[model samples]
Target: MIQRIQTIFLFLVVVCMGITIGTELWEQAVNGQSWKLSAFAVENLSADGEVVSSSSKWYIGALAAFVGLLALISIFQYKSRGRQMMLNMINSLLMVGLVASVFLTTNGLNSELGMEVAGSYKVGFWVILAAMVCNMLANRFIRKDEALVRSVDRIR
Candidate 1:
């Protein structure tokens, strides 16, 4: 069961979340001031590359960790395909929240720093989106497995 294609996708979801938790999501330099946004904080960096100040965003990291936990749990629930599908749906919602939280953080930082627009996204942000895609693919494959099981049951 662990060899299922969906399992691989689920594993990838976990990997992406780990990266999201550990890396900076966005970066910008304006008015000679630099800033970096990560799951844990929004940091103002001095010209020499030092953290001048930081505002905490621990909730974003918490949400990402929760989503990753759900994916890992879902991977071990292959016996109950329906439940696995439900978990993935929940993951989808949580992933959306993660994205929204990141966006809101960026907006909040822009306002605080008096910037016209937010900076470009970095690896952490994109990786979460990729995780979402992988989650969707895993769900699709789970559905296919469920349908096949139902068909076989009917034939017996």
Candidate 2:
């Protein structure tokens, strides 16, 4: 039952991510605003500085890819009880990555694109947060399964 819930949650997360991408693209097309790519300076050194930055769109794409991968893994593991536990761990880590990417992209968009794109950022934040909660619940289910297996083994 928990596995089933997790599978559903994963599907929802994928849908949310898709919606986020779609909304952003629609807004850009309707407004006639070109997507801006900007570089952020991570470190400042004398005159020349080392910058580690990615475009707002790139980060959104990355988050979508990560969530999609996790959703696929969840579906694959649905058939097997043992594998679900491992998949849950992977999903949790991916969720963390997704959330972080949302924050990074939100900050980047605010700085590069201004308040005009704030709606997209807000929607992305909520979706990512929901995904995080779902992933954490899935992880808990995995732990519960582990304990159940151990108990059964001991009884036998």
lDDT of 1 by residue, 48-139 (tens): 88889888889999999999999999999999999999999999999999999999888877897689877899999999999999999999
Segments of candidate 1 deviating more than 4 angstroms: none
The lDDT per prediction is 0.94, 0.55
**Candidate that would win on TM-score:** 1
Show the lowest summed lDDT stretch of 10 residues, model 2: 37-46
Clashing pairs in 1: none
C-alpha lDDT of residue 45 in model 2: 20
> Across residues 1-156, which tens digit of lDDT does each residue of candidate 2 receive?
434666676677677666555443211111433332211212112223323332334655665666767666666675575677676577667667766655665466556545555433345446666766766676576566667878999999
In terms of lDDT, the best-performing candidate is 1
